[model samples]
Target: MTNVVLFSGFGSHGKDVNEDLFDRCPDLDSAAADILGYSIRDRLRADRGAGPLDSPSNQVAAFVVNAMKYHAHREDGLTPDIVMGRDLGEYNALEAAGVLDFGTGLRLVHLRAELVGNADGAMAAVLGLTPEEIRAVLRSAGLHGLVFTSLNTPYQSVLSGRPSDIARAEEILLRAGAYDVRPIAMGKPFHSPLLAAAAEKFRDALRGTTFGRPRIPVIANCTALPYRQEITAEVLARHMREPVRWHESIRWVADRFPQAVYTAVGDQRLLLKMLRQIFAESIGPGPTGATSRSPVRIPSY
Candidate 1:
């Protein structure tokens, strides 16, 4: 049987995915190079030298979605039994699933980054804390602006809000017997009400966009469920400002694909680490273990 694979990450571009795929199939480098162009190569190199190019999700989505199409055209088609994403990665999965065309998906992601990039905010990883404990701390501190942006795993979650509020919330979480809280380097607060304006702008952008029923199942960030045919661009637009239900979505994947191998495609291996932490006992040893693949860092193509 073909080993089922589950792919996910935040805002990792096509070049990234292509690079990862290339590692598995080295002879495809020329074809990948041809499709990605010189600009992509330069960008990828630069990204490697410096840190990750913040929010390349849209560009990556456009490339990978199209690359899959190109592969489909060539008969050496790319297909995954299940595809999913978290936050910006959701757009990638949407494109892979054929819910949103490449152009529309990329456009939406770019606009999303621009809109959310302006806000002053902060996010932090709260390790060794349950979601309920984190929520209780936020509530007790009267920090109304904070939101639990990511439920990555049972012991790990991300909290996002205005910088001041997040700082305060960090203290509260630490005091409540949490292991540690460290700030994330993201520029804006995502998956919170703070990005409501951006969501509206995204909704407007969606009007001009077209979406077809997906060829594969697409797990949405907001709902963490397989998208129904009735879900429109407007519904996806609303996801921009809403919290990502990553934990539930991952649970869905685990329950559905008990024997599947998960490969997290993106710059940072954050999602991969979380998966290991969450599914520790269930996975076996070695790289191909139920949870074994090393975090694949796709060169920014």
Candidate 2:
């Protein structure tokens, strides 16, 4: 029975895990305060009260929530065999698997947002269109700055590029029969080359940090493979300017662990929702002979 623990990226956090966690897990709460130089709980509250959280708020909240949840799950005797994270969520995954300590992870998260700053480009989700379709739309428009960044699910993909180009692409996609093309509220055009400077700085930060091998296996978002420890930092830094191959990452997990039960411990069940979509078709051995990923025994409990 493989237990794959999932953590989501920025912009997905809500008021899911907050003040309640301080009392439930005092140790974690204290650690957060000690490392962050203030109470993360207080930050969460203030950030929420301020209305929609910015990129920094979402990043902080996502990590804090997942870290607390990981510890709580441990106390409940639920240790993961594999830890996987999506996009920015990989920072917490590294911490969960012991590749990085709490202090390093939290500080890195903060630094990541700081370095990326506010992006000049924009990101938008084009639902009901495969990544391939979205790319075709961009190409037809002869847009060079805009690029597909995240493949969230088979049918949903996120694109990041110039705001004007994004607006133009939205119109084109809608006309092409896209179910919905909504803008994602983010300060950074994550996973896009526009942040090349930020990515380089992030790589410098990564080089300075010590990345040990994970106690529990951790699947990386960029390569959809286990972190090489020594090169994991490079992969993480590249993620800033490259696409998050999420669909492939999930497929990699399912193919390896047929009885895998994916448990999402983050802002919400974003990863699980994507997982269900990936497993939607009862994929199995076809008439050709070999089996594709499907009929997964994802426990419903």
Candidate 3:
């Protein structure tokens, strides 16, 4: 039974989130307090990373959610053969695959917030256009500052740049036949060169942290491949200062694990939805887990 588990970027739907889910588990609850503070559930649910650190609320909350849910699944004796995540979800994959411990992951995310999260950069999604198309438009518009942050789909590109450049890119994209040029939910140039300086410092944190070998392969968004155990920290740090090759990573997994069953955990509906689309486009419609034609099933977590 090949099971590849996935983690979503940003976060999952907050509707079914259990504010007290961690309270039922001692370790998970304690981890929450380590970075989330008292009233962990309530504070996380509130998205007010307004504690002493004041990290980005959305990012910290998503990290907590992914970690909590992964541990819950582990407590139930569920383990996946392959683990992967998009954007911030990479930490979830690392922790799940035994790379970083839970508490350490939390602290790293907090540190990431301090270093990489800034008001100077912004992110937005340009829908109904390919990365190449977006680049062509950028070239035409002379907006060299904007960069492809994440290639979520063949036709969808997440872009990041300065606030002014993002505004200009949006206007130019709208005028250049883009179906929609909307700002990402929590707009920031997350995985773009704009974060290089800060991400370089975050690299020091990654190197300082202890990294264990993964029990299962953990695909990284930065390279769209399994992370090398020896250079795991460097690869993770690069995720902040590089474009996310999400489309390629998903496809690589599907090709590698033909007939593999995909199992999504935590708040992964968005990622799964993108997976379906990715498969539909690359391999044609129908079941979209393994290869285009491989029989696929999404087993319940």
Candidate 4:
């Protein structure tokens, strides 16, 4: 069976996830901590009580945790045929695909996080609303500033824009029969036009960096597909400014590799949960471990 490794972005949960990873991979963990100016364990523990970390520290801690898990997987002699990372996790996938070195990727992530964190915007999750429905809400509400950030599932989408616009959209969605409308604890809106400045800055920063074609196909969060050409500064820059077609990307992978074993990586099983939801909505529940359209199944790490 094809082996696919799915890396989660931010929002890694569980009390012991960071602790266990820190214990397992001390060296890389230490390096990451040094770069971030705080221990990931401390940060995670604080985040448990507080809300999510600001973009910079959040990206740094998540990247380190992802690296620790990835190293542990390699130690167990596990490898992947395909690697997919969502949002912040994309940097991890690039490292896995041999397109970027750990140090360089981490450095870039730090820079990206800083630029994005400094922006003035907000994001919120709208559940029980289809992509079209949400778009309609934005149009009907005249929320020109608000935009769909991520299509996490058939019935879930994220809206991002200025704080006022996002709040307005959230209220509109709630009144329109959304199951839930929750704010995303982030310093800046991601994957939205509000980040246009950050995207442009990041693109310029990427010009000085080096990148190679991935060893395996790496599906991008921005397009929900494999890179059409060489991944360049412009491509990554555009990614920062576009919506993440997560559901479409996962479905594409499932359809392309029907027999692939989709394994969620990192500290939690959020990615697996989302994948399962997507499969259920798209193809309906099938046999215990089978998707309706394919034998592919989402397995947790």
lDDT of 2 by residue, 166-236 (tens): 88988899998799999987736888899888999899989888888889888887778888778878988
Question: How far off is model 4, as Cα RMSD?
Answer: 2.6
Task: TM-score each candidate.
Answer: 0.76, 0.90, 0.89, 0.89
Cα lDDT tens digits for candidate 3, 1-301: 6778787755442435765556646677676676566645666555434422233655676777777777677677666899888888888899888898878887888788777656468889898888888999999999998888899888888899888899899989988889999886555678888788888888877777889898999999989889878989889788888999989988888777766666666565666677777877775653553434434334333
Question: TM-score: which candidate is best?
Answer: 2
RMSD of each: 5.6, 3.9, 3.3, 2.6
lDDT of each: 0.64, 0.77, 0.76, 0.77
Extract clashing residue pairs from model 1. 13-60, 14-60
| Candidate achieving higher TM-score, 1 or 4 | 4
Candidate number that wins on lDDT, 1 or 3 = 3
Higher-TM-score candidate of 1 and 3: 3
Candidate 4, residue 162: how far the Cα is off, in Å: 1.9
Candidate structures ordered by TM-score, highest first: 2, 4, 3, 1
Residue 65 of candidate 4: its Cα lDDT?
Answer: 76
> Model 4, range 47-142, lDDT digits (tens) per residue?
888876666777787787787788888787667888888888888888888888887888888898888877888889999989888888788888
Error of 3 at 262 (Å): 1.5
Residue pairs in clash, model 3: 123-188
lDDT of 1 by residue, 204-247 (tens): 87787778887767777788788875776766776877777777
